[model samples]
Target chain A: MGRIYKKPVSMTKIAMRYCPGCGHSIAHRLIAEVIDELDIRERAVGIAPVGCSVFLDEYMDCDMIQVPHGRGCASATGMKRVRPDLIVFSYQGDGDLAAIGTAETIHAATRSENFTVIFINNAIYGMTGGQQAPTTMPGQKTTTNPYGREVKVHGYPIKVCEMLSALDGPIYLERVAVNNVPNVLKAKRAIKKAFQIQLDGLGFTLVEILSPCPTGWGVIPKKACEYVDEKMSKYYPLGVYKDLTKKK
Target chain B: MKNMEKYKMGEKVLMKGNEALAEGAVRAGCRFFAGYPITPQNEIPEYLSWRIFEVGGTFIQSESEIAAINMIFGVAACGVRGMTSSSGCGISLKQEGISYIASAELPFFYANIIRGGPGLGNIAPAQSDYFQATRGGGHGDYRVIVLAPNSVTEMGNFPKLAYDLADKYRNPCMVLADGLLGQMMEPMEFNFDWVDPDKLPPKDYIVTGCKGRPRRIINTLHMIPSILEKHNWHLYEKYQRIEENEVRFEGCNLEDAEIVIVAYGTSARISTEAVIKGRKKGIKVGLFRPITLWPFPKKAINELADRVKKLLVVEMNMGQMVEDVEIAVSGKSAIHFLGRPGGSLPTGDEVLDKVEEILSKPASPERERGK
Candidate 1:
């Protein structure tokens, strides 16, 4: 068979450790392509969160630091403060960023630390055996909440991008999905723009990507994308919440 | 007159302890001050903000203690001297950042004006943070250099000393003072020469990295257990070196003294007055003041163990320094404690009466005869 296309230079040659058909690899490749296109690979520092992607340090060619669970924002804050000349970004899973690291995320945004945050919302905790997360939809069943997530008991799913967009410190805030090829392309553009905002000295930019976790969501790889479109999109509603560069 | 003038360091200035500390930080070339206002130590950040701006420095009133500490972390990572000041509860909030700074081996100064605590206990002066400051407040096996300044003059000089010691050792150093010293006004001399931050030796370990050269990663991650253990061992060795070279103490008539008063900070100030009162009554009592609480002056007090019949440790808290005194005395002499908690400062008369009671005791002939 003839080769279909060349591998993106930004993507690592090594085999990925993520589950088969997982959206992480796609998201990772897209971010890598953006970094390659922008020519920021050398000066870019990636902060790996304490989740399934904790070993992101090994995959990326650039320098990376693994932050404690719920402390990716704090570590990125420290790094950006130390090296304001460099382009810094953090990649965090929903469980890590939305739950344990909620305080750090809010405070970092409030302080408007000049860094980009690539937040992945998979609705469920992937690494910890499909546990319920802060972004888990109402009435969603998980290992922790087997019966179902009752809003009265567990609270409604948090809309992080919408919440953070209200803060003046954040220069850009957008939510996108990886459920389809077209949406995946849009998410890549948002991610690149988020990093570009920091490069321009604009403060606190975040791009929330609605990703699919096939194994955690208890569905086949293709069906996982369908579930994200049918259920997750209804709740998350992907779009730009705040774009300071845009005019009315 | 010209020859005598050549021997002098600088002129004396009567300044409040907090103001003196701010001036000392500036003199030490500290250009970044980020802190939130708290009781007893408000003057520290207040003075530094205006003065630092006047000296072409940066001063920020961060939204919270967490922001203030992280700001310091950022500036320190740039290889510049940065500082933050807070009282008890505020210090508790800064512990996580302190741990990271310690593990990163970044040199910065933190002034913790201790107040009564276990939780928002009181804004009043207390040495309750002794265990937290000297024994590592955060979650880690790290030790920070703790300088306990007794008087306002020492408060002025301690910041400069703290900056030097932090850079020399590449570790966090704290100026641990209480509310009494933080609030008190006293005559201080800024005689020490300042070290310009811009002129200091370049730090190769800073996170700035080799711009066009090798890619350097600054992190505290050690996947290998043995490497982490080795790093911890090296830190312990540094602590040992600091203990030997940095331990400071002031001995007042310790030779042939019957009773020795062991104290530090404001408690030491009250102990000095008590020693004078005891001497006026013809009691052979002396004072042993610990200037540096950590890398504590154990050796000096141990040497005085044989000379003094009794050692009395007076403190604001209940018997915090008494343990150190006992460890120093090692059964050589009777170690006693006189402390007041909850913002109470023991007066000279109270300490003097205790000294008389200890001296007037009959029974042991040698102890009585020595008095």
Candidate 2:
């Protein structure tokens, strides 16, 4: 008999459509498990962004609003303000959360809006055929940056966690990876903690997860997971950039 | 909060169109207002800041028009009435959110106090946005209820009508006023019973708050091609129903008129004056004003073409609505157009001169037969 070890009650029976070894399914499962564990499924209002993950409503069993690209934070801020009783969070990818939506993410964090932001940084644009992303590492090749990213030309990678840490409003900021078993467990903890802080009526919270995109990275699934561990983590370190609770 | 009546019902007050429109939203129980400052429409959020606060609501002069519209989306999703306003440039920024709101079927109101523009044109009165409003302003095949208010009283009242229609259809409605109507001072009455948002039926579809309910999803994406196509067809059915039911227009002196002028908003106001002057000069000229510019009162225009020999369209832009008029009349009447773009407004006498010029041409047999 197959014994169930751990699962999420809020995840739907529908099959996931993510690519092979894509970390999005893992991130979604982690968030779903966290929401189920916290018993906030009934009150959770999720804002889905405009990328490959735009279909979060298909998997997440909670109330979900699929928003346009780069508008996740603003949409969540609006719903959270009117229905503060509900737990509102926006799930966004690197391009949606960083480049086009930079203003929304910054303003929402600076306002300390009482909500949660789950940012998935795969270092490349996966949905749009592996274009160079704002989070794409230097000396790396992408569709837009075929010659490997030059620092002077593309500018340095956007350290979103560090940039957000400088802002006064955000109460929690952490960066985690989901490359291996131990890291996957740690990523779950960070995601759960971000949601918990939102439940406690804390200020804005963000958890940057270094997701793997084997297709975008032009590698096999195993190589993609290994690349996230060896290469991605170096540029985006695994730690808490800011925690107001620790300060207090 | 102090115990005082914030507004006097049935009280006549001198107010600008933008101020009255803002207060009108307050009376409509629009509990949330988020907007960015743009020329010709700044008074809207400035008045709503205090007025919405007095009503125990929220007002945020957001960082950009981008943030402003999405903020409105946030509150609207939570089942409260939310709104935003701007002129040309700010409105262009709001189109993305408008497409989202329409696709989600979120009922809300937004006002565009029209200004001269292809891009950051100027803070002057113009109806250049007619095509944008009548046609869907953003991507996808969708339609929004567009109300063109001519007078300050209409400016004060159209927001309530817009919101009512918005809730009735679960669609977005816009009050398309211009800088001239928004900035000019006039006496307007404050009235209309404010409906409580709590009592509204959208609670059935609102995202979660009071626990243990089925999760509601407000979305626009239907990835499966057939399913998405079906969704578009459903939206189209609703739009067709709206077109049949919501066409509104005002006709002045249609009987025994040889020439008819078509216009709306400020141009209609000037055309009304022109019709009076044309009548005094024994020129058989009249005015046809389309209030709902999208549904367009096409039937009236089509029917009038059977009688009127000549038709002229006047606007603050360069020949936008003429296309719609051409479709309606179908060459049944000889058509003429006069417009002043780049923020130029044609006065009543100037429009009268155009009507006189049109009347100077003797009606050919084909023109008289409306061929």
Candidate 3:
């Protein structure tokens, strides 16, 4: 009998601290699998953000650094610039990436910094107790937006993929979701390609994963997945917004 | 190596203060620099923009001061000597990032060529950032090693000292200067030998890769209150060690002097001349310039307080370091302040005038301790 799927060698045996049914587990597993398949685990450097994914250093069995809130890309830029040989990526949440770190994200892309960013957009601030995020859906009710997000009051969701696609510095930009098995597979592919682009010395590749937050969304595990597929996917369309590898 | 070919060992070259420090950093094996432009310190990044590439080093004109400091934080994590620079308003923006660097105990160096400021004050030189620089300039209970250099030669040389102390303690070190020291042109030789970064020893704490060892995680987050408290204690111990072992200052004419002028950085330079002039006039004055501002030369000042009748603190601010001097003296010596805040630099004549006026007064009996 052939060997079936097993836990990735790139991941440590420590138990994850992510909330049950949170998409961080899936994204972590996918990233670990990608790192293992690419055989760059030894030379991989991960920058963990301050959101719920702050414990990314615990799960990923690679040399990692935890940066201040929302400065992941800036730190990643420093790491990758100094040690261009190492594979560097910043694991950031929606608030970490788009809200407080908006300047870092935009400037890193504009400079075409040679690193990968795994952006998990759960539409709400997870570690901070379900507060509104930059990607929070309009009419969505969060801890800060109990009456539901009004476009006039709370502002529209920041379409990161679309916004970054307008910049010429990025070599690849893709949006994927981990709501179902097929979508999970696509998300993994996009992540692997983003890393591969970085390995090729391509500049500033990012994959925005529309991850689910069952606890934050006040929904069961299944309903969170259903909400991502039914409602979240409509607001954040899934596809490649920019791919330099693809010619017109 | 290629970029530094022009600079000979022990050769005194005429250069601008900011540019000399930039070159000195490259000589000190600083292979990475990320800085944003601000007045008085812009020349550092501007010079390194071309100079760093000559030696195959990385230089980044960061999008903001916050980004620059965070980038250096990353480089330091990689076990490389990285640095950043800015003036007052910009350093204000960098406080949060500096806090993170200190909390993580990352070894990095930075410079603050301070301009006048309570807000975006002015581009002129000022020592107003004394409180901000010595008091951690950021959140949390942390202290960065602060070196106040008065001369352009010290500006060129202090980067090596900052790097040495930073690496020794795994703490951030700051070379605190002002616009006058940063922009003035002077001839000075670098104090340290040329350091090829590749020749430096590898750091165990650095996060290069887990090639043959367990993975390394450099982090500052301690979620549990007790654990965080323990981390703070650990940091406090390191700070105590630094205070014990690394306090540096310069004392001139202290023997038999009746009064002492306490100052650092630009004010120290001015007071040096004032002390010399006051001596020619038989005023019996001395200068005590603190080289390390945080682990401030408290012992020397306290002892001097026992001998001197008064301690006159000259600063380009509204009497900030005077409080520290008072704390060090503990009411043993009467204290007087001469301030020229908001970028108006005090001349030697002005400081000398203040020194004579304080000396002319009868010794205050209230602050006098029983001999």
Q: Which candidate has the highest DockQ of all?
A: 3
| Stretches > 4 Å off in candidate 3 | B1-3, B365-371
Task: Judge candidate 3 at residue B89 and give its lDDT.
Answer: 91
> Under CAPRI classification, how is model 2 graded?
medium
- On a 0 to 100 scale, what is the lDDT of residue A81 in model 2? 77
* Model 1, position B355: C-alpha lDDT score: 83
Please provide, for model 3 over B1-371, each residue's C-alpha lDDT reduced to its tens digit, 9 standing for 90 to 100: 24465587789899899998899888888999998888989899999999888888899988998899899989999988999999999989999999999999999899999999889899999988989989998999999999999998999999999998999999999999999999999888876788888888779998987999999999898989999999999999999999999999999999988889899999999999999999999989999999999889888898898889788888898888888988899888888888989998999999999888778897673432210
User: Which tens-of-lDDT digit does each residue in A5-121 have in candidate 3?
Assistant: 988999999999888899999999999999999999999999999989999998999999999988999999999999999999999999999999999999999898999999999
TM-score of chain B of each: 0.93, 0.94, 0.97
Q: What's the distance in Å from true for residue A199, model 3?
A: 1.0
Docking quality (DockQ) for each candidate: 0.28, 0.67, 0.89
Model 2: residues with Cα > 4 Å off, grouped in runs: A1-4, A246-248, B1-5, B364-371
- Model 1 clashing-pair count: 0
Question: How close is each model in CA RMSD to the real structure?
Answer: 4.9, 2.8, 2.3
Report the lDDT tens digits of candidate 1 across residue range A16-133: 8898768887778777888888887778777777778776766666656555566677656756764678788889999988997787788788888889999999989998899999
B1-371 in candidate 2: lDDT tens per residue? 35324557677889999998988887777888888888899899999988888877888777788888898887778878899999988888999899888888888999999999988899999999988888879889888999999988888888888888888777889999999999999988866666555666655777874266766788888878999899889889989988999888999999989999999999999999999988998888889999998778888999999999799889888888888988898888888888888788999999998888778887543322110
Runs of candidate 1 exceeding 4 Å displacement: A1-32, A58-83, A125-130, A214-223, B1-9, B362-371
**How big is the positional error of residue A113 in model 2, measured in Å on the Cα after superposition?**
0.8
Q: Which is the winner by DockQ between candidate 1 and candidate 3?
A: 3
Q: Whose TM-score is greatest here?
A: 3
